[model samples]
Target chain A: MAAHMTNAHRRFLQVLMSNRITEGSEARKLHQHCCETDKVYYAHDKLDDFISTINSHLQPLFMQIRKGISEDDGRAHYAVVNLAETEVTKMASDYTEMELELFRKTMDLIILSENGFASSTDILNLADQLKTKKMKKKEAEQVLKVFVEDKWLSEKNGEYTLHTRCIIEMEQYILSYYQDLAKKCNLCHSLAIQSQVCESCGIGMHLPCARKYFRGQTEPRCPKCNEFWSCDTPGVNRMGSQT
Target chain B: GKEKANELHSEMSAFDSTAFAEDLLTFMGINRTEVEETNDSEDVPADFLPSHAWQKMGEEALKYFRRAPTFHYMMGSFKSESPVRKQRIE
Candidate 1:
């Protein structure tokens, strides 16, 4: 028993030492990159760009660490930390890209619906419908407000009318946002009922869930798939039995 | 005996008056201001108020304003007098 305890202690110390070394190396590299670039790489205003740059450079290093750690009976602690951080970084990047794309698409939808702005009421009604279907109230409100603001609908004397441009804009934006949201849901390992397909990525998911995750009410990444989603899509339905 | 009785009567009369005054104040509901004044003078500590009081106050204020007459008018409803019914001459 004494010998076994000693062996275990030695193994623990070895693992700890290896982890410290790995962490030290990663920290050094990040520091060097920051110094060489002189551009505050990690703390830059453009988070998406920074995240992508880091991932592209650091992914291989993380894989190598993982390979080394997995070889030992006692998994290397630093390797796990590195893997988790990388996943988190990837998710963050994906979410930012999705959000930018959603905004761009929403703007385009507004421009297209500029003429038939009278249909804003219909869109609002649709928003209400979404709410009744268990879509988050705030999410529904935001999407509806975006449509109204885009001039797809005109409000006069407390009545809403859909603008011609609004219709086209709504259609295009909704289709794209819905599709991308779905794809994000899939990436996050969500089991939300698929609603729409992204023209760009061919993904689907519940709109309410997407909204919840985007608003920071829930974890920013999908719990299952760990994928990042754009915050712009309201009413994203998350998969799995919600506790 | 008469002197002692008079002193006791005087004391009872003063007590009755004080009780009557207190009852009158209560009936008139005029003691609320006095109570409020006393409370103000006591200087409650900042933490004495319930933690959620500010949030509740804000919500209540919002609800109150939402039900105000001007709010209804601003929401596009016209304030108009009802039409009078015509009565036949008896």
Candidate 2:
């Protein structure tokens, strides 16, 4: 039995050293390719064969281990086997934890934005976008906390408002959300705060400001209206007065 | 409970020689001492239970130790090669 176990272990080590383990997308592609080339063999069969080859090598050892249980003393045998199994499980859990930590560190280095805020939503979106990406939820949360601390995006009054300087730097991002609200009357340089949006272009304006900018013309145009312009058109001067 | 105990005992008795050796050692209350004892008469040292128990216990311990590597392999616990590959995108 001992000799059989040694042979199994040695075979396993040989297979490992030879890099015979199937892994990743490449393995999947290979399986697909093999399946396509050989009608008799399916991709799943190849995978099963790979697993069984490794299993066969180890079966002898398992048999030997089971052989150590005596019928006369059932309780003691079960206890020993159970203890050994528990030890193995504990070792596996420790290894999984270490692997998870390493994955988190790698993601932290790669996914953080320049300003240091790792948005949880962004990370989740990124994971969704990248099928090959692997990250645990706990690790993602940790990365987000680090990003918030570094980027200074702490919440105040239940809102994630940036610090003053960051707000200035993030002007474009802030403006994007409020672009529809920016309107001015054609006549007045002051910001237009109210009125029906112009039919020609979608823009709300203060009624007086619109009349003043149009020079008392019957067809009053919105000063800051983007009717003829798409949002992306550059160099189009805004009509609204600077606040 | 009595029926369950009987069932368990019967199940245990069905175990092979390797299991018998282990059981004998446990019954004798000798922990790992039998593992190092050789087959020689001096090694048997009559003070212990009969020589057969010593022989059987030694054989069982050795078998169990030898099987350790195989058991580790079967579970993929000791196998370094993971079926899943780490992907690197350039």
Candidate 3:
């Protein structure tokens, strides 16, 4: 059964399968292997591929991998988390009203902004927009801690970015509950928060551009996805309706 | 819950990309210990179970992983009661 494996892959399998088997020698071997991989993979031209390989192998096992540098240690690190034991699994659904309020502010900073990373100060400053009596910087700091520690957000050098876990686990909620105010126009190449969206294919176009595109079509369709774009909505025929 | 977890275990256990990951590790002359997890926790909640479609996705993801190493961009649905991503009810 192990005939197909190269010696290295077999060694890795031995390390993975060791937890169920024995203690002392296996532990030493596992540590040795981890260090070898760290030196070779992290420092080589294979950085991205090495990360990908680890992720692909463990994803089926329900392991979540993250890259971070702890502020306390200031050393870069990679972590593997068990999804079943992780509090991050349903954290979005478990948000308190206050947490959700802060999440809204975070959305404005990360998703609605030109760049994805938002400084700690930006998150704290957005607290002013909250309807609550006072949104002090201390409160934002605490909320950011919750977000980072719980793995909902990934922080680097005091700038926070969305994690892949959040994207995968919260796909539907984000698509349905929130509008992408930062969508860039395909034609004009600028943010088009108010663009009409195609429900079938989920693309956006400026209403004026859509109107011009659909001018002569008896059955208008999205140029990108070829999905039917209905013109029946309010005053869709108003281009020549004044006549 | 037990049934869904079992189903997930069955689905997940069918594909092993560790060989491919290890191949890349070997190619880089990195003799890493296999840190790949082998099983999902039996206590996984029903709500946390992936959609029924994940079985197929697992196969596809494995296929992609075997050809190359990047599977991070592959998406799996976690929507509750979503039409295309309905979780196994039973």
**Which number leads on TM-score?**
3
**Once model 3 is optimally superposed onto the true structure by TM-score, how far is the C-alpha of residue A133 displaced, in angstroms?**
5.1
User: What DockQ does each prediction reach against the true complex?
Assistant: 0.01, 0.02, 0.01
The CAPRI quality class of candidate 1 comes to incorrect
Assess every candidate by TM-score: 0.18, 0.17, 0.30
TM-score of the A-chain for all models: 0.18, 0.21, 0.37
Give a tens-digit lDDT track for model 1, residues A1-243.
111222322232234333322333453444345434543323324323432343454456542112122111212223212332233334332122323233233333333342212233343344333212433445644654653564333455434443323222233233433443212244334322223233344454444444434553443454444455433354434343153
Off by over 4 Å in 1: A1-55, A58-125, A131-139, A142-243, B1-38, B41-45, B48-90
User: Can you list the residue pairs that collide in candidate 3?
Assistant: none
Model 3 chain B weakest 10-residue run by lDDT: B70-79
- Cα displacement (angstroms), candidate 2, residue A174, comes to 10
Error of 3 at A8 (Å): 26
Off by over 4 Å in 3: A1-95, A179-243, B1-90
Q: Write the per-residue lDDT of candidate 2 for residues A153-180, one digit (tens) a residue.
A: 3433322323222222222322332343
Candidate 3 residue-wise lDDT at A214: 72
